[model samples]
Target chain A: MAAQLKGARVALEVDNVTKRFGGLTALDHVSFKVYEGEILGLIGPNGAGKTTMFNVITGVYKPEEGRVIYYGEDITGLKPHVIARKGIARTHQVVKPFNELTVLENAMIGALFGTRHGQITEEEARSIAMEILEFVGLAEKAEEPAKVLNIQEKKRLELARALAEEPRLLLLDEVLAGLNPTEVAHMLDLLRKIRREKGVTMIMIEHVMHAVMNLADRIVVLHFGRKLAEGTPEEVARNPEVIAAYLGDPELALKFVRRLGGV
Target chain B: MNDTIRKLYTRPSALIAWGLVLIFVVVGVLFKAGLVSLNTATIAMDLMVNIGLALSLAIIMSYAGYVSFGHAVFYGLGGFLTGYIVYNAVQTAYTANPQNFNLTFGRALGWWLEGAVLGALASAALAGTVGAAVLRLRGAFFAIATIGLDYAVLYLVKLYHNPLSGSADIPVTQLGAIEGFFYKTYVLVTVFFIVTVIVAYLARVSKFGYGLSAIREDEDAAEVLGVDTTRYKVYAFILSAVLTSLWGSITVWRQNSFGVDIMFSLRESVHMIAMNVIGGLGSFLGPTLGGMVYYALYRATLTKLANSQFIVVGIIVILFISLLPEGLVGLVKLVRPKLRKYID
Candidate 1:
């Protein structure tokens, strides 16, 4: 089913991206492409540089070697806000909702200044913020302080905030990491709905194979900042390299096999 | 209407608090008009300076999340500049002869205003320049850097005192007889109070204000949300310094004197922090309310005990930190929901 969508145009292209921190090479010659209107899954174990890849793509950390070309423009070392203004926004692994602000106000911030356009009127921003909150199923808690939100709600708030920016490309960083089984299912449905209804391209970093295998059109596997495999979710799942890279852990491989049950 | 009033009082108790402030002002005016010889009028005026100082600290500590123990650097510099201006004006008048030592408010208004404005500008420049370097360091490093800067300024001023201009404690008996001098000081305080309110209001409503609050809450989150945390933090520091400098100029004018010890004292910085903490960090009216209460307590009871005031203040601060971390404004907020419950 996922292989049928392989012809989608490239939305983001990373060519030979490398990042070094002090004496350690965090990312080494990483390369991949995210297709337009498709859910791309980026996966790796702890310290495999999955988050660093997201950081590099979102302009948080500049890659020492290589270019991040977004929609045919080289956005190699732009600031985060500039990147956001250029139609890319991201959420943190640890949800970073502005605790002091109400949920509505937090979303309103994204609506007000996400793009480099003229100042938005207060009423318009409020309406848009409220609409985003409603879309994310947080309208009832619009006026509530963000600090009081539970973990799932906080993650949802982060998503709502990113969505409020009206980004062409939305990056989800471990958003489903801490969610329970039912919550994870709901989030997967929400992601699918967002992609279907909003026509927004997404890049999600996940450790959960089942969710990623179910949602992602393509999977890019990373190990120690280097791309190990890139293909359709089924191709990556069946790759011998991915299985060996999971430390030949039969339980993990079995989980991936079960997730791809009939695929 | 009930909710409206409740919300108004919740954030901006200053509006209601001003009613009590106005009544006090009226009573003070009456006292000045010969109803009483209350020497404590000066104390009340000094409290306004404290308010300005506390507001400055609140912006730095509460809004920007940069705890500065070196705000006195700007305050002391403002005082010194103000004193230098007055000294120069008096010298020019003395050189012309006629033995007119009496510096009337009207005669000195131009130079006085110039001095106050220049003092604030210079302090802001200093803060911006130093903040560019110091604000790069966070937490305790930032605090210590500011303290070190304060001491450096104090030492330099101490070594460079002017003999012809007289000592810092020079009696202002000559200026005392000048009509409207005290009135000018009062007006300056009023201006500062208005400025503080306006700044606090902007901090509550503006995009930059939200950026500051976001930074305070979570810097990394704010950055990812498209807020330029470094730029906003620098702006906050500079603005806070400028306000503190203006208050410092007013303090010098009110006392008609300045000295290394008085200007550079860490006690002033600590008092400013205490006022902000005890008022309510990040709340709009927290610092002002805290300043008024702190001043009232100091004037009414603690100051009479001289050195023991420090002990009393320490205890009060400890009590606030331990019992009510949100300070007076926080305490009011805690009581408010209960009050609403009762009313409902």
Candidate 2:
């Protein structure tokens, strides 16, 4: 997997990006590359600017300096919708489903307006939305209003929405955050299926160590608005600094490093 | 054909939209047949104006979730433009050939039609410009900005006198003096009303409408999901402004003259918003229904309550808002959830 990743094309590059909010620096010269068809896990302690990086990449927040290159083009500071049309899709940590719209309708918005938007007719969008809902295991709830969904289902809907956009690069923010072990396992399988079937490159920010550790081809650790470490899961698990960063948060510190001992 | 148009003809939105148009057609036909009294025909015309204005506001307010509190600016601008056109065109013709200054029915009709079309274009231009700026604001800020723009335009119109007329009032009474002018104006308004309904219905069911609905539900999320929020909003605003302006033009032609004070009044803006709120916010049918219900409420209370009719209307609007945020359409959905799909 590591050999293949090294040879794969670079799908996205965050080059020396610095984002500031008021006086405080949220991300300081943070930089990374997301390879094509690879799942790069972004793991960080709380307030480590994980989400801020996602925001910068997604064009929700413009970086004070540096560029977000997607598919060998500088796409920095474009509008969110423009970025979306450029084939970058993201899931919010706090899922934002169109509550009044049906689950199918919610997914349809992605297909109707996302990448290749004007080309896709309403009927085509509907079928695309239905196909996505099926993939996300939300087909049964397709006709129901999104507000009625449980947290897990809502997360799936978020993923479904992003997927329906046909994004080349998918940003998953805490997809497994509030799920139980079984649900997490199910989501992990779904993620694997997505990567395998769609071959879409993904950058997932997760606190669920075991899942990210097992799923990601490579891991990038962030700490206090800076890159703390980057390596394959085994290499990152063995890094003392990465372990030290996790030490402050005991729940992650134990599982994040210790769970990989047997590997 | 829009795939959104269901194969089954029983769709609630389709029924409501076409049914309202049919009513307008019937009234117009009866008026043409001379079976309806002028007073009754005028009342029907007034109802069409009110509903048309409400639906225009609904395109932006309900669908896109941009509550433009100063929507009457477009309405007044329409009237003012029509007045300006009629006064200028007729007066210019008279000056050019005063000896045979014959304001024939065809000439007068030509001026009024020109006024209506020009009014619509001017309104669309203004909305596109203003919406680009004001739509950047959300919620109350956007509403307040619209009100500010409304007053700014109103005061500007108040200050300026047509140099030709040498007065602020630009009377189009000559056009009204033409034979059968009232009935013709009524017919024009009815046609415009039908156009407004069709536009609103199309906006609700189109892919563009879905994008607006997504914006209404959650704007930031919608943008991230690839909806061009700014462009969609401006388009919806233009659609709304143009429709309102057409109504305004027709109305001023019927009234023969308009006062800037009343034309640009915030009261009209509030009424448009009230109608939409009373009916429902987002759906095309909601505002149409709301407009009718609002007009009915006004007529019902006008005789009994005298000057406090609006206060009564205000109380009713507050009741609807507090109890039914979704408005009349919501009430229907609640009663018959089965009918939700049938409705927009």
- Whole-model lDDT values for every prediction: 0.78, 0.87
Candidate 1's residue-wise lDDT over B103-158, tens digit each? 66876756667778898888889888977789989889999999999998888777
lDDT tens per residue, model 1, A74-125: 9999887678778888989988888867899889878766763245665677
Q: Which stretch of 10 consecutive residues in model 2 chain A shows the poorest summed lDDT?
A: A247-256
lDDT of 2 by residue, B185-288 (tens): 77778788877877888888888899999999999999999998889999999998998888888778888886677888899899999999988877877888
Write one digit per residue (lDDT tens) for candidate 2, span A156-175. 99999999999999999999
Clash statistics: count for each candidate: 0, 0
Worst 10 residues of 1 chain B by lDDT: B335-344
> On a 0 to 1 TM-score scale, where does candidate 1 land against the true structure?
0.91
Worst 10-residue lDDT window for candidate 1 chain A reads A115-124
Off by over 4 Å in 2: A247-263, B1-12, B92-102, B162-167
RMSD of 1: 3.9
Q: Indicate which candidate wins on TM-score.
A: 2
Model 2, B34: alpha-carbon shift in Å? 3.3
Clashing pairs in 2: none
